[model samples]
Target: MVHGGEEALMRQYAIGDEIGRGRFGTVRRCISNATGEALALKTTPKAPLRDPLDLALAEQEPKLHLLASSPPCSPHLVALHAAFDDADAVHLVVDLCAGGDLFTLLSARGGRLPEREAAGLAAQLASALAACHRRGVAHRDVKPDNLLFDAATGALKLADFGSAEWFGDGRRMSGLVGTPYYVAPEVVAGREYGEKVDVWSAGVVLYVMLSGTVPFYGATVPEIFEAVLRGNLRFPPRAFAGVSPEAKDLMRRMLCKDVSRRLSAEQVLRHPWIASCGSDAVAG
Candidate 1:
């Protein structure tokens, strides 16, 4: 049932249960009244923009999402169906990714995915990042929780643009945001960084998918930060026994501690592992 007095405002959408929540808002499952199509509605409260930084993030989120979903849409990105704002909040209606997020899926699968299966998913994600980078966007946060899937097609979709930013050639970004496990060493060190950070995060995702373990781990936040800064990436023999050497090579390149030596998204897409896997590997 719709909230009181919301029915008239949301006449076109039959709002359902809350599906997700973040620092700024909540996402509810909704249905279009005319076509009865499923959609996810993200609502952010305008009242929380008291802080200048919070307001900036609030405004940037929609812009970034729109840019990624614009003409020449990348198949691996979540589509923004529509957007509108009421007096108290902003609402974003996007594709309903019924297959849920990759983290949940990975957990259910006993914490790891087969090498071939992981390769297919990583290829699609790399392609998506390549598209975004070409358009001057850097998805600062790329992790399992941000990856969603289409139930019908089994296609992977990159979601969440809250931390994304646009950068021009030669420009660098300075920030200490992003999930601890996936953040690049440069970011952990508070140094200026560029799009390469996303590649590093993608590499972390691949490592986790193939090994069911994080490349860097610690019992506390400070310890995790130390581990990340130390940049010791290990592939336990048992965990990587079945993973191919080609895949490991790609991971090494992507997860390089020295950002200068890291592979770009385009390079990642062209790596021997992805190339040999073929297009079938990316199929839903």
Candidate 2:
């Protein structure tokens, strides 16, 4: 569906319980009165703009999601069904992933997943990132929390385009955005960076999924930033004893400190580790 102006938004869906919360809004479970289909509604308050940058980011999110949902992109990406603005807030109606996010799944699985399972998830995510990059969109934040699964099928879907930006021209974007633990070394160093940053973050996601620990750690933000700049990539003996050498090799390629050396999303998708997951590993 195309953009359904505010009237259609309020008239079509019966908003229900709050499912999640973010800095700018709350995500709620809703049901479409017209079709009785379940949906996730993200409502962001239209309060006065205190920080102009925050307002710009809030406005950019829905547009990015819309772009990614268009043709030529992978269906593994979460769909943005519709969006509209009202007197008090803006509502974004998206696909509801009842199976919960990867973070929750990881926690429940004793904080780590077997290599095969992690590889399956990584294959899906790498494919999603390839689609996003092909469409000229960079999903700067690619953490486990942003990965959701379809309840009935257990298919993974990439969610949250709030930190995404268009980079169609192959130009670098500036700004220290993204979670500290997953931020690329170039990004943490305040250097102009491009979609390769997404690859780095995805590598972190892969590492955490397989080993259940972040590559860079510290007691404070500054310390973490320092660790990232130092660019030390390691697979501790205990955590990586069972991990395949090919998996470690792929991780190293994706997390390379030099942006030019870092694997593109497409390359990551073709890496042996991801490719070994097989074509049916993730749903399109």
Candidate 3:
């Protein structure tokens, strides 16, 4: 995904090597020349003649990045230091998490994380989502790959806003957006959903974090979509032995198929499993 225009900005950071590739671009490990700080730079090609979905996805990313950075209570969102569009590509300099994404970590550990560690990460994610909801933003994508953990502080950040949107009083949108497995049933049904969709995604995320696999999965995308639509939520009893029952209860509340019955970010923060995370924790 690296293009020449991004090379200009990459020079400013003294990029040393390629880190990895994301859905729409590539990331590189680099050191900031000005501050002697290490970071990751993500680059995406400009959409002069890209597919409709790619163009829409690129257009959505930066808007949500701005919203995430604006929330003071938000957990450490990837900091966007600089950005610019070249004749052929778009460049973004973002905070680098050397510890990598949750997916990488989970893969290295055989797909399961220790209960306390997973709970801790989930608490931070819930807090971040609560902050976004307060500001009328919804992180339409909430899977492990989009969750990054900083090596220095062990702090978690929610990344990839390609499907996120502002839905507070002044701003609202209707469309089917988000990865199929993580998308809420209402969204799949073509209903006009609000931020509660994020709660559903987050619940799926929490379930995966605890159980080592998604609650709803099928051989095909449409089949998976059908499972989600049917509200076929099942958890492995043995996989959740040591985790708190309250944690499972909270996930159940958040993943309710009916958006009206689903718990709000603030309410989730107030739930027992979340409350135990901290006194200052904001509930959703």
Candidate 4:
């Protein structure tokens, strides 16, 4: 919205189709009549009661999105422009990426993506994560659904920082948050962890991109937790054919069970597999 808090702006926008919905809100693409720029409007209802933890996270998310957007980086993150809280709902205006998300692409392409394409995507995503980590913003969620790809430029972006946390004073977190399948073992084991958790999730994402399946699978959360704790990734040699050893090594470093031993996002950006993508091709 154009105005400040506690009231919705008078400006009218042509709202497009719904993009996504979660427990707190729904995101819809909109075209601002005043500016003619496409923006994603996320509306979170104000009245309904919710868990205290969730409410706190919801209130903090918009600010974090704003923080990530101010300086801007490659593998563009969705930028939050304005926010207003009314009796009905809290509205957020954000930059729009019309190419949808990685989940949609994977669904359309029969699951697994090609190595070259996935590597390029990984490079872009790594650059974005490096930026976020450098700023001390931890993107707790890093699944396919949270990754948006710009088809026009083949640029992949990290989106939906709803679960993100800012690292003030180098504080580590202890909570069983984030999606079960994508959450790291340290988090699942109820151990204190930091940004490395995101790297682990990114490794799981890379595995999915290359093989069309998650590295760990089970019928229930506990089973998945056990599998993650054991760190048994079933990457048969034939599974990801022609995938460079450097890439696999990097992935192994990311998925390391010990959070302290895991590679930082910046280190991952410099990995041979990522470097092989080339400077011009990879995001800055």
Candidate 5:
């Protein structure tokens, strides 16, 4: 619901230079007028949006994000302080992540991360997804691009709930949503699925971190979808020779073709590799 332009968001936070841009709008750096603290402000204009799904997403994002941030909020999540609305745009104030996203981190580090570091990052993402799942919110899009890092501490935080959906009441969610490289097979097949899809995507993220390549890949979108449908998970000896067996086993369970056999986020936290990195990861 759009909060009538009754309260001016600019009165609370001074909008500054543009920092990033997305499909719907731009993200700018802003500072609180009261405490002199810095934050990020996302402004999405509503005028140009006419598609039903796009409009639905613009409204659902803030609500689902707030639901996931209820009592006992996870630090792994990029805390959204408030959301403001007007006739022109929707404003979202969230914690600033100046260290960039996981994609940038991977690119800077020669396309792959060491096992211990990968485990730590994976554990953090898993913890974040676990918190989202408990609240019945499924983050349909779980990729490096949406995982941001802090400026000073370099801590990881999951962001961008635009593709997230509410799956409460034990109800299954239907619809083809998510990035092709990270989307689950069930999702690609247009099947009704639940929170487990997040685990599958997270598994793909972890696999990419460790091997610097996707498990199911192709030259085109159709080829990639086909490979994902076949569900043949493998660890090329050249890329996975140094990887531990436990890590490989964990990915196997996560990328399993049988949704029932897939492990949940909480179970992923209990995995040996993730468990060993628990101290470094945010609470699950």
Candidate 6:
């Protein structure tokens, strides 16, 4: 996983100030010495990972990233340029999205996005998820925190595959990974599930974008899990007043309690809401 150039990393890029932090690592700004271009470097300290499962998942990040970015890679995925490890930690070099993540964007915008804009973003998100699924991977944590932006390009890019896992050949995955707000019900129930779990999370994301609220409501984690298991959706008139029926329909299909009935990432792309993007919404 180190890719053999551990010492060459520091010689190639000048790591700068911290830009973000997550459960496993800290993302910092870095500059390529040769190109003078800026990028992101995620450093995961190898010290605190005591559990074997934790270590395995940590090592799996780069492998999953490599698999997901394989040829015909989606433009929506934050590109992983290189990965290596030094004495103290594993380092990931990736695209630098200077505009910040979608969570910050939503907070600044009163927690809601216009229909057309939300549609465009949802299309990109679905495209990224589909790309992962096609590569036999599952982005278990498909939340706003993982969606980033390029300030200059104004394009959203999905990042953070630390919770992602491979389920090649249709093998099922079972884990308690992912954030509470965006987690799938089957996962919450500890049941074996396929890649469609990402679809459920994506639906929650689209729901939040269109309505300013999480589909599953609760005052605490347990309460939220209860809401997720119940799976009742309510589109309050005030919140969804301007949202078109087709958009709501897509959400319903995506958030379906029956995993068998839930739309796949590809099916999501074919949904009318994504088609509203007016360009390549139905692209294969």
Cα lDDT, all candidates: 0.85, 0.85, 0.75, 0.77, 0.88, 0.87
- Judging by lDDT against the true structure, name the best candidate: 5
Candidate 1 or 2, higher TM-score?
2
What lDDT is reached at residue 171 by model 5? 93
TM-score (all chains, Cα) for each model: 0.91, 0.94, 0.88, 0.91, 0.94, 0.94
Error of 6 at 161 (Å): 0.6
Clash counts for all predictions:
0, 0, 8, 0, 0, 0
Off by over 4 Å in 4: 1-7, 10-14, 46-49
Preferred candidate (TM-score higher): 1 or 3: 1
Model 2 weakest lDDT span, ten residues long = 1-10
Q: Taking the tens digit of each residue's C-alpha lDDT, what string does model 3 give over 1-284?
A: 22246566756678778888866777877788889888777767765536776676675666666766653536546666666567766666677888789888888888777666666777777777877887778888888888888787778888766667878795656787888888899988887888888889888888887778888898998998899999977667787777677778888998899777899877876787777753342222
TM-score of 4: 0.91
What lDDT would candidate 5 get against the real structure? 0.88
Q: Candidate 1 or 6, higher lDDT?
A: 6
Off by over 4 Å in 3: 1-11, 47-49, 71-73, 277-284
User: How many residue pairs of model 1 clash at the backbone?
Assistant: 0
Question: Could you report the Cα RMSD, in angstroms, for every candidate shown?
Answer: 3.5, 1.8, 3.5, 2.2, 1.8, 1.9
Candidate 3 RMSD to the real structure: 3.5
Q: Which residue ranges in model 1 land beyond 4 Å of their true spot? A: 1-12, 46-51
Per-residue lDDT of model 2, residues 210-234, tens digit only: 8989999988999999999998999
Off by over 4 Å in 5: 1-3
Q: For candidate 2, what is the total of clashing residue pairs?
A: 0
Candidate 2 overall Cα lDDT vs. reference?
0.85
- Candidate 2: residue 134 lDDT (0-100): 82
What lDDT tens digits, residue by residue, belong to model 6 across residues 185-279? 99999999999999999999999988889999999999999999999988999989988998989999999999999999889888866876523
**Native-vs-model 3 lDDT?**
0.75
